[model samples]
Target chain A: MTADISLTPPDPKDFLDTDSLFDEEERLLRDTVRDFVRKEILPNIADWWEQGVFPVELAKTMGDMGLLGMHLEGYGCAGTSGTAYGLACLELEAGDSGIRSFVSVQGSLAMFPIWKFGSEEQKQEWLPRMAAGEVIGCFGLTEPDSGSDPASMRTHARRDGSDWIINGSKMWITNGNLAQVAIIWARTDEGINGFIVPTDTPGFEAHEIKHKASLRASVTSELSLDDVRVPDAYRLPGVSSMRGPLSCLNEARYGIAWGVVGAARACFEAALDYSLERQQFGKPIGSFQLTQRKLVEMMIAVNRGMLVAHHLGRRKDAGTLTPHQISFGKMDNTRNALEVARTARGILGGNGITLEYPVFRHMANLETVYTYEGTNEIHTLIMGQALTGIEAFS
Target chain B: MQVVVCVKQIPDPSGTYTLDPETHFLVRPDEQVLDDTDRYGVEMGLQIAQAHGGSVTLVSMGPKGSMQGIRQALAMGADRAVVVDDADLKGSDALTTAQVLAAAIQRTGFDLVITGTESTDGYSGVVPQMLAELLDVPALTYATEVEARDGKVTINRQTSAGYDVVEASLPAVVSVTAGVVEPRYPTFKGIMDAKKKEVEELTASDLGVDTSLRQRVTAVEPAPEREAGVKIEDDGEAHLKVVELLQQKKVI
Candidate 1:
């Protein structure tokens, strides 16, 4: 006899039971981070976004919850599974992409470099404090002149008396103003080098990028290094090429693959809620065929994005993840999420324009998400290069 | 100080609920979670144990699947847990549940027992008192605050007006009301570590408690819905109708 098959309808919230893919600890981690977001971040996020400020105090709170560098081992880090880290990112971004960006920059970009490539002394001196959020760190690589091509970066470091004096500027640096330490990448005689530069050093300056639009709740700044000198002991000795910074970027891109799913889910949820309650033509808007089509499309995209992100996370944990795979995930998920957000915005109509609902805010944030950490076009080319053995970059 | 927190796995309160007409009992969905109300007690137990230099152990009785909810308490920093799960223990009443829990607590041993005033799903509000009676300990209910020190426990018992300070010696049961302490979110490390923590599972026979339920839910009926409000249209002198209605209701 055949086993009984119970074909139940999918849960609207999790349409595919994609949640079951995660183990117990991973699910608990997601729920805990979700709870923290609901209680702490969601209530005050709109105000913070409007004021163009991120509450830096949240770093220590997240640190206490072991969210900072939570996936790393040793030095006060939580050492959670890779999928757990991805799930945490998903929940954090569900609140706001800016919040998840803060965590991604801290954990994947900042701490991962020191843990993966820094000297024993460097890790000993900085990892614990950074993990505790007692000290904040930022990664500096992209410059005003270089967005997609790091090989064209103008920032260079010259050796002088067993010390390095870096004199260049970095643009679009996250956590720049708040970081106590910075992982500054500079071109050198040895191809490229990573420096552990203290933000308090003389001649090193950070100016907050101000004015209109996207990721306003996040601290983006420009760093001007006018002969910022550091001892040789401050340098990461593990490698001397673009590999050092590229690896860090790769790690961050993995998190982004998972994070944007949250942004999409949030917008989708808001639209669904609005559609049900909002009345048009003497009935709920959700009852309309056109509105249902949008909702169904959103649901499919979110479920598909979650599957992609989770698959990438598993591959990463198994040590089989490739750069092209990361690019595929980041590019596809971000594009899908942005589309979902835009569709959700249209569903909300006039209310979608206001910050009272999260739809507009998410749409605005997804624009930055789509552009940063290897822009959609760059990632698309990277995927194209993988599929066909051809050099696409000029 | 050894503390035991009595917790239960219940249906997700936020989800849609239904009742079985034949059994006259609420149908439990496949999605079950740690009852939100029990977090207050778990937090209280953790706090007392942390402050007094002892470990907190969670004691629960439910289906074997209840481990999902039990691990949640463990993730909140409880040292370990004892879960009594038996197929025959299904449809247990408050007294039956108390008997099973009392046996588990006896086997686990506790200097103090902490529990919520009632579970969110089945709010009988009598399990803690029954468990206290079964264990032959002082039952302190509706405690807004509890302090265990010097081989005695003191509680700020919430009353209708304000609160009363009630004290009892060691080995007491304190059912904390919500807001006694804000439940802490489980840290990432705690969540991972909880997987490794020991959760000793037992059956009714293993705990050696009687499985016979003394109370039965005979019939269930939905409460009557509220009557629609009186809608008086404004015919320029609607204030007179409102005043007259209030006068009939003796409010004027």
Candidate 2:
């Protein structure tokens, strides 16, 4: 005979014990990143957001924590499991998307290209310091007119003896203002080639983009490469064409898929707290059926987004994750997070529009996250192409 | 020099707790974390070891399945850990805890022992002294700043007034109070490295120590509820009423 055993109820925050999917090490690492974000970022983020300044000093601290290039192997990188890195992204993004963007640009965009396709000399020179946050790097791929179509980028590199001279501008570059070196992808006589251009080069200038309503805490810049010259040693001797930049985008897009979950969770938690403390009709607003339904929706969306992120992270670790799947996660999770943030903002009523609560800030930040990496429309097309075998982009 | 830190894995203080009517013991929550008080001790031990060319070994006693606290301390840069876990050791008093810890520390062999002056859960504030007596070492309590040099340890011991500069020979036990030093958060590398670090588990029988309880709780009751404060309505003499209440409480 089997005796009756009582099952414990699910935690509303974790609801499904999604944490059980990770091992102890992953959880501990996640907690470490969470604590770091809580202690370092959360308290000061509002002021930073208001000032439109991302402290360049924190790059060193994050590098010290081994968060920079944390998923990559060798060169003083942490080489942690992909799931752990994604968990770190979740926690960091929970503080603010700008902080998470800082890490994503540093690790996936800037450092990843060097680690993946750079020469031994380049890797030896940059990876260790970049991983330690001593040197900051930014990717120069998106041009003023070229957002979705990198093949249409006007930045061109021409051979001058053994050296290559580049001329063009890249817009909306994260970490551009502070980058010591920039990985500028320019179309060459051969194909698209990536050049590691030092910022101190005579023709390299970065102008900070101002008046951003969303992602205000992040540094967005317009890079002018006016006859920037670099030696052949600086060119990444890897695959030519769009593959190099596309792979790096895939890496960052995967992180974005996980990062926005944190933004959504932050808004949901703020709304939940406000609902409980806010009183109307002689009781807390949370007592109402409509409010509870919104809460449940946010809770389900956050948890579902987390599960998708975890599943993709596991596949990435197993070396089986496909690009279309990443696009799927990025599109779905970003859309869901935006929806959750909007719903949470509605739940907060008048207070939602204010910066006093994180709801509005997260909602605003999710607006940018929705547009960057790959827009929801672009990702949908990627999914559509994968499903129906039709190349739709003109 | 070898510094061994005594850590306790207490139920997370932030979580709710309940009392067992049958046993008169506070039932532990499912979540366990390192005692906040003991962090200073562990940090001090790590600092001493880093400066003096040694390592910090963590020693803890808890239920058989609890390793979260020890793992956390290890992640904070402790070299290794020795945990004494056994079901038979339940309901062990302060003296019995001292015995089990003394036995385990003897095996670990420490040149210095560090612990919190008092645990957050058990406020007896007597374990360090008892452990020192059992180990036949001098006990220094309430250390806010610690320094080890020339085969000796020096501490700024907190007292009724300010603090006292106390010096003791090596092989002594030091109980650190909070705010000695800011504890460092574990880096990602440290967390991964902690998984590979050695954690030697032992039982009370393995330690060959007495597991007998020396004290029993005769009664258990909830703390008395505090009385509500007097509310003075403003009648253009609110300041005078506040002054009178303060005077009544001897605050002015």
* Number of backbone collisions per candidate: 0, 0
Model 2, B1-252: lDDT tens digits are: 899999998887766767778777767754477888888888888888898799899999887354777778998899999999887887889999999999999999999999998888878889999999999998888998888889888999999999999999989999998999988777778888997999999999999988877788878777899999899999999999999989999999
Alpha-carbon runs more than 4 Å astray in model 1: A1-6, B228-252
TM-score, candidate 2, first chain: 0.98
lDDT of model 1 at position A334: 96
Candidate 2 lDDT tens digits, A1-394 = 9988659888878887898999888888887788788888989888898899997888888888899999999999999988888999999999999999989998999999999999999999999999999999999999999998888999999999999999999999999999999999999988999999999999999999999999988999999999888999999997688999999999999999999999999988898888999999999999999999999999999999999999999999999999999999999999999999999999999999988888888888999999899889899999999999998886
lDDT of 1 by residue, B170-226 (tens): 899999999999898777788778889999989999977888866677887678999
The residue pairs that clash in candidate 1, if any, are none
DockQ of all candidate complexes: 0.76, 0.69
TM-score of chain A of each: 0.98, 0.98
Candidates' chain B TM-scores in the order shown = 0.91, 0.92
Give per-model TM-scores.
0.94, 0.94
State candidate 2's DockQ.
Answer: 0.69
